[model samples]
Target: MDKNKRILSFLISFFMVISFIVPINAEKDEKNIFKEILKDDFEKNSSIQEIDSAEQKIYMVGVEGESILELLDQGYDEEKANKIALDIQNKAIESIKSFKNVKIGEKYLYTTNGFSITTDRNTAKKISLLPLISSISEAQVYEKRVNNVRNILEIASIKKEYGLDGAGMVVAVLDSGVDHTHKDMNIDSDNVKLTEEIVNGLKSKNKITYGKYFSSKIPFAYNYADDSSNVVRDTLKERADFSHGTHVAGIIGANTKDGGVTGIAPNAQILNMKIFSNNPKVPGASEDKIVKAIDDAVKLGADL
Candidate 1:
């Protein structure tokens, strides 16, 4: 296959691998919870930390918690910088008690400036602004909103009135990876077979594209002083949150399949920009990778 075709094939196979995940318990309930709490925060909804974006679990990446990279920037050695990041991650954990789901990857993917957290957004936000965390955006959705809203602005209504189903639209999902075979996604190609026929079928769909924008892996290390492309590529042998990207893709343009859930824009095209990999049991996606995904999306002619 040519370069474009080769890239697309990898994406198709990637989607096939993740889309087949068997939903664990509470999957349905978690979606309801996400819609209730995250319907308002568009950023959170799009973030890797979003509910069900990673097998219905919370996933976070941090640089502020340990401040390792920051310390190195200030002239600290690798050992000292790692020690500092771990220290901050630990202290912050104790100071902000009651924040559950916090974990620091031994390899060091974190949430705050010192380390990463996996707690609810409200608590994370509260702690993030304390000068310890570099940014408050890393928090999770804390309290579940009592009120539930769907398409509150009536965008769906407007789209319907204008007879728009996002046909010819290009939407990007910057997450783990997507399962293209989900019944509700309206995707007809399940290129999981990896045969030439399956590959060509995936290419024909044209609705889902991959590797055209961002690469399967980023070439830089978290420290930026050295290249860890080999390490990253090796880690990527196992990707994380595969279902999350697929879920987001389905939400954007999933067509109705066998009476399954239909997407808001059934005809819109979807792009798979996998930015994270499996780490710390659940696998992880980092912030810098996300920024790169956004750049790739914009360059790929995505309609915003």
Candidate 2:
């Protein structure tokens, strides 16, 4: 009886030790897993007290699921890819509710099973522990790198050599917005430029210019930021709204008819998919926006 009692006591103490040590080991393992996936840039930037003091910062989070491309690569059709995306969104929405004050801003299902979250570092650390979440990194702002335009003659030579006139191809432009009124970009016979009245009408949210002003050159346009189909650059608004897209479109397919830069493929029709908002807080295309744009491009039949 004495020996049996001692044996029972040892077993109880052993389990008690394990119960205490197991949690510590698990926590350490969790931190190690997070450390592996947290990008170096975000890790370095997070050390700054100023950023930490901010109310919230945006983060690009990866979740546990295959992307649309991956699904398609695995022999799933377009319909299945879309369904998978929806499932990922639903799961992410539910998972986000588990964390207090952590909000999902955008869902990226086509490129990755991930979304953007607006939360502080402390909450983000808690979120990282979630079984569904695969990785977390701070959102980064991208600046447009301007380089000297290559000689038009060289582009023409390449086009001539390759016989690539971009005929029947839809080139999607995901930038601030496109100035369809630009003479070089206008491919329609009417050559309709947005008059001040129409511009004012759009500003006032009038229905007059809702479906008009878009030409054959820019056949389709959508502003993802505002969930509107208005991709026309508002002249009355900030310069950023109009400048970048038009410049980019010019370099892509600007017809040299009216003394514009003759792009490499002057025959490609432009698909204006504006991702930037007029709001200064959103500097460039966040990861979610970029992935959304790519998904749109696939659905809309963009060649490039």
Candidate 3:
């Protein structure tokens, strides 16, 4: 009887130890998985502070590195770390209240605190933020009146009379790639064979002259200080960094035979010289690339 009792007690103690160890190990594994996923998402030593506003969530970035890691180490999850970051950001914003002598990075600090200001970092000029303030009440759309202009039927009638139903014109779009497969924009017919293909270095056995691909969505130009050669490329095979050039191309040369809207220059051939992307936050296209594209366009005998 004594031996049986001792064995039972040892079994109970062993089960308790196993139970505690399982959860701890599981939690550790979970943390490791989360860390792996988040490691690539965060900027190097950078933190983001989310500010809750009535209108939109404002995020302040580029917080000091050590402070962010320290918060993470304190058992504060990512959310708590972000909140503390915002607190620090709000403090920095409050420090620039008077705005006597503004430095380069110090200009827009007060916008978080409900003040507007503009600064030219290169020239070191300060401008009144008052003009920057706008309201929906002050907005108005202008409608232009053309003499003897009627409805769509009248335009169609005129087009028919002039025999200008857009028969033999090609427009080249060089913007973000067109949504060729869009329900309203797709071109289908035996005579009008529209092809979508990527323009990178590889060649496929079944070659269709034109098609869509991921690389064509990149921007035509960027203005950052990084070397243009590292980011920009001549062939469409190179990934498009921005979608702006594609969008522009769509506007100027999307196939109109498919009952889509006509472009400003509908008859022109679209030679997409993708040079800039959708949002050109950077300055502009590289000068050499721009010049080369222009020279190629001119050599192609483009009317423009």
lDDT of 3 at 179: 36
- What is the lDDT, from 0 to 100, of the residue 280 in candidate 2? 63
| Deviation of model 1 at 68, angstroms | 31
The candidate scoring highest on lDDT is: 2
Greater-TM-score candidate between 1 and 2: 2
List candidate 2 segments past 4 Å from native.
1-54, 187-213, 225-230, 235-241, 256-261, 280-282
The C-alpha RMSD of each candidate to the native structure, in angstroms, is: 16.5, 20.0, 27.9
67-140 in candidate 1: lDDT tens per residue? 44466777988677656767776665566554554444222322224333454544444454444444333312
Between 1 and 3, whose TM-score is larger? 1
Off by over 4 Å in 1: 1-149, 187-241, 281-284
What is the Cα-based lDDT of residue 202 in candidate 1? 40
- The order by descending lDDT is 2, 1, 3
User: What TM-score, over all chains together, does every model reach?
Assistant: 0.36, 0.69, 0.27
